[model samples]
Target chain A: MTSTDTTTAGKETSKPTPQMEGTTKEFYDFCQKKELRFQCCSNCKQWRHVPRLMCAECGSWEWQWLRSSGRGKVFTWTVVERPMHPDFVEDVPYAPVVIELEEGVRMVSWLSNCDPHEITRGMPVEVEFDAVSEQLTLPKFKRRNNPL
Target chain B: MSALQNEACIVGIGQTPFLRGTDDDCSSSLRVELQACEAAIKDAGLSNKDIDGILPFYGLSIAEDLAVNLGVRDLAYQATSHVGGAGPGASVANAANAVVAGLANYVIIPGGWYGYSGRRVRQIVVQDVNAMSGGKTARDFYFPFGLTAPVQWFSFIARLHMMEFGTKPEHLGAVAVAQRKHAQLNPNALLRDKPLDMAGYLASPMISDPYRMFDCSLEADGGCAFVVTTKERARDLAQTPINILGIAQGQPFPADDILTREDPFHLGVTDAAPRAFGMAGIEAKDVDFAEIYDPFTFQVIQQLEEIGFCERGSGGDFVADGGIELGGKLPVNTHGGLLSEAHVLGMNHYIEAVQQLRGNAGERQVKDAEIGIVTGFGDFGDGAIAVLGR
Candidate 1:
């Protein structure tokens, strides 16, 4: 397990890390390489996220990982005023957004550049890789100048 | 009509006192569950040996242990519903099916937890997001972004509704205010004495954007249970039977991921309402009241639209102007709901629905309420609906 510790006002807090196992491990492995990818069914050419073994549409076990354009729009968002976890206490009032990618898949990520109050539905955004720890890379998003 | 329709009815209901603090007498989850179960069984005028089936909320308690403690023998039907808060209401449908199918003569559905005294809901979700069905995605994708709680997850939908339909913060406040008013009539409500107005609701501190502390349901330590038996047998029971007119459970198309859904505003109730109404041979207009599973204030509005109580995008308006309050067009959450009442994972909704149908709700009862709707929502919009009539 990889852990990151931050000290705020002399108190230490540990950031939560996802367990890298099963299909989840593969997706994070790609992220570690700075390549954001989702599973695409080789049989039906349908895209799926959160890394699954089989395609929900065609029910075929045959699939392969494909790179995403990482371009999308903010479908919706929320600004957390109260952090549920102690690690995020310093980041209170942070915004998490659901970005609907150009490929039609959606994922939860944070806005790396935009203010939480400035975020609007359908606002254009593109993914930016962040290496938070030695073994993990998260795909965060930034505001896009223009829609593609 | 389905064979299960109107075949089974809820005969008895029981619950532990809704409390923000722990009761040393009933410390463990199972102990509270057993207390509720014994009360329900006795309420039904039946003995432990008479209960042949059990439907428990998933991961809360096991049927074998519940049955063993209750001294229930010859347990025939046993299953668990994994739909989070929807488990209790969905279990009603499951229990009705079991009794109608002759798999069991009487079934007990129970839900309980130490939400306040022990680990809170956020602690449980943080410990294991995968505990939820189809929640693996939440762990890998959502949790890392600091989107850990239901308030955060549902806030996305709430914000989208606001953007799409002109829903305002005041609209959400209406739900909180109305439920708090009803809670004043409920002696068991955790927030019964804490009356709230629109101004008070707006003044509450924001936990998540668009959702203040008032918008959230109370975290309570308690348990609730209800008994289900065939309608023919219900006539001999101690209480007036609340017939299960219709019941249906559904999931959003994606089931796991909320953002990827074709319609961001659509919920499992969108798919379930029609089928449940169809089974009951009724329409939304026929419901005198609604016992919606209200974990959050915005959820009540979302479910109102999806359950066909009002047009989509009009729930905000429908809830305003005393719409869901007592003596309104549709009195909702008459027992204060999960919002003002304690959250027993929506089991209290079932108990409240039964009380209303039986004309037992004293001060908060909707006059002449012969039929009502009870709904459950959980796990990224998985929903269940049960129509009960006297």
Candidate 2:
């Protein structure tokens, strides 16, 4: 609910959708249901992203979807200006951040609450869901205070 | 250990004019490839009948298609190198391997694209896609969130490099300015007439933070090709043979995921350099010039450091005070590179090295160029390097 809508950035260009096929369906479905989840290995307990059937660390096929605590810190970021695609032309000057989650996994998302100039490496952030389309919802991040 | 060492030599080099923007009725990518391939065949004093083997980089020209077009009675070998921009140098190595194995006598490595004019018709030379990550990669998680394009991914790396090495944006500008200076001397360079100073580079609008317009390479419509054969055959050809001293290819761990690389600044050159240098029986200091694949300015700095030309993280200092210019320690990208020349992948880099070694490079040729090297950087951090000498 805390994710701010950025549709005004570009109208003709629709918000990009994740590939909703194969092992990634569950991940996208969870986003639409307002839940932040990632895949974890059943054997070595390693967290991974992009929804894979096998674990990168342990070669374990027995894995399960686990809900993230919705917390992480910024590992790095880029403020995109004059995006390459015409679909993203209106969304110029948006900051896409790569976050290292508390569960020891990393993924890319956009910063929600903070100004682009104020963004820095290793800043604490928490997840928010922005429902761009009826069937598509994206996980974004916002600056966070002390967490439980 | 050195299976292909000095087994092959680059005898001839050819290219189409690196046009910044071509007319709408210009040749297609395949045609450009054919043109360059034919030109290279002629340059080598060989005809269609002599070309029994074909090794292409980045899928530029299909060997079967070229064979049919050239009306060759038989085609002995055909091969290709993978990795985006890093394929050309490796393709050279692949050609040498084929030659030593007695598969083919003459191998041609050809590459080209309609980078500029194609964009007018919505045909971008380099599309930011998720294919490099395979069917399932970190890109699927990131793309929906508006994290797209190679520039954005590199911006992330630039930030990390800045944090780790205190590298400044000016260091990147230094690369742009120096390459443009090199371009001014080469008539074939696309940006030869256009001037680029450090102030202009800094004043240009930022495409992605840490990358200005000049920081990226020129997307032009051009084609380039090279001819390789045995040293004995090359001595009798149209030009002096540039000996293939060494070649090697390497990749970073989790090569598909740029975000999860073991170290953000560390790249495939960490492994490729040592193997290539070892095979060449030389060290970094022995190289008189280098044509490192530089799609972006910062990559020149990174590759130089990783290739052991300078200490790790000393790229920022190595590029200062005209050190990379002609008559300096290592004159890199003397043909203006992708930044000022044309983005024909890194095939043009190979051609530049060939020209310098043959002692035929008109104005921009390095003085007494004895040994030189060319490196290619590819998608998601894979790399290839080749060392050549006269």
Candidate 3:
């Protein structure tokens, strides 16, 4: 599912904009289309995150974008009380969770609709897309209804 | 022992007054860098012409600029360490290679910055995200989630450590308290006059969960430098040389991404420590003291485990019982460390190791200290380690 709340996203102009280039840009482009995907080696069947140009396991350059299960558990999390950027000043006390996806890769994302104090390790989560800006769509996580 | 063992020695160490603030005109990083370098050269009883090599902390100082400004007659070799704060510690290994290989006679590693007065570290990182060693991932993944600061990034690891090993906040406080106690005896420490206790540490403001204001390192305006030369050359210098027994640097499998690593607790130091100790023909127990990079209080605990001071995941308990205090089993951060001392990008840690080895550390000196280990933890857990002996 993708969000169309442009008004809320547009106000966060001061937030750091991702430098869209190479494999990194390709990963974000997939998010823009409301699909959570990671780079998988076509030859060795290895999955990697943040999109890489080559596979580290077998030293292969053949890879393709594969859809993620969007289901994972919180590997860890931190509640940032102070705002490092001015844009996040109003968003103080936010929790950023590191999610270990079912695909055996990890990514840093926000835990949507969860209080900072309630986050725990191994808490199950599922991904949802947010159209943060015209050029960006971020994949955020929410508590899974059935945490198997 | 390796050929490099006891071959290179730190002959001189120098630093600028660690200040919380500086005058507008005095905030030139290059100026302070040059000042520290001159002091080091003079301390070594050597002229600018004697300095034939330079290993600068990349992005903070440049070798070519420092060489010209110091008036080096023959700049034979130059290199920069790109491992963030690990640059200084890793530079020792690089300098040792240069001196042992006869590529240069004397190498100076200088690091300085206006971390507090001028563009703060956060400002610099956010200004140019791509310039950071792993900025691409930070820009694309971390920044969007409001994970912008080092404290925030490291907090996740700390939280996980706490969850898995039951590391208490008091354990973290023990580190802050112990280091602050050490700082009390260090006149050069910025927090020398300020005392921190377990109570005071718990009362400090929380910038990030599990990391209080006191848990973080000082962002100050200062600089530190040291001169590295062969052990043979060190005997003729102005000061007693602290032999460089062994040094090594390493990075995590995915050096750029901390979350994706196989073991979140495994850092660059985990890999570098063994190699360093092996080169020195010593083990962890042979270490008389340690000067770990303490960007945050938890890092001290983490590095202590990685560097083999104590058992893995037992660091919290290790520091809980005055274990890392001056009179404890293994004194750590004898110069107060980055936790209380000014952060000169970890060059100060290296300088402290040299002082302890030279038996020049006045009040905080580790008595009968003969061997010491110094470490640097840099961008995304990159690590460097050096074994020093008198």
Write one digit per residue (lDDT tens) for candidate 3, span B1-390.
Answer: 688987999998899998888884543588888889999989999998899999988787678788778888699999987789898888899899999999999999999988888887776766666446787788778887888889999988889889989999999999999999999999999999999889999999999898889889999888889999998898899999988888999998799888899888999999999999999999999999999998999999999998878887899999997999999999999888888988888889888888888888999989999999999999899999999998
- Candidate 1 lDDT tens digits, A66-138: 9999899998899999988776898988998999898998999999999898898889999899877666688
After superposition on all C-alphas, the RMSD of every candidate to the true structure, in Å, is 2.2, 3.4, 2.5
Error of 3 at A63 (Å): 0.9
Clash pairs for candidate 1: none
Docking class of 2: acceptable
Candidate 3: clashing residue pairs, number: 0
Task: List runs of model 1 lying over 4 Å from the truth.
Answer: A1-13, A146-148, B25-27
Better of 1 and 3 by TM-score: 3
Q: How would the docking of model 3 be graded?
A: medium
**For all the predictions, what are the DockQ values?**
0.65, 0.47, 0.58
Q: List ranges where model 3 is wrong by over 4 Å.
A: A1-12, B24-28
Docking class of 1: medium
Q: Candidate 2 — which pairs collide?
A: none
**Candidate 1: RMSD over Cα atoms?**
2.2
Q: Per-candidate interface C-alpha RMSD?
A: 1.8, 5.3, 4.4
For lDDT, candidate 2 versus 3, the one ahead is: 3
Error at B33, model 3, angstroms: 0.9
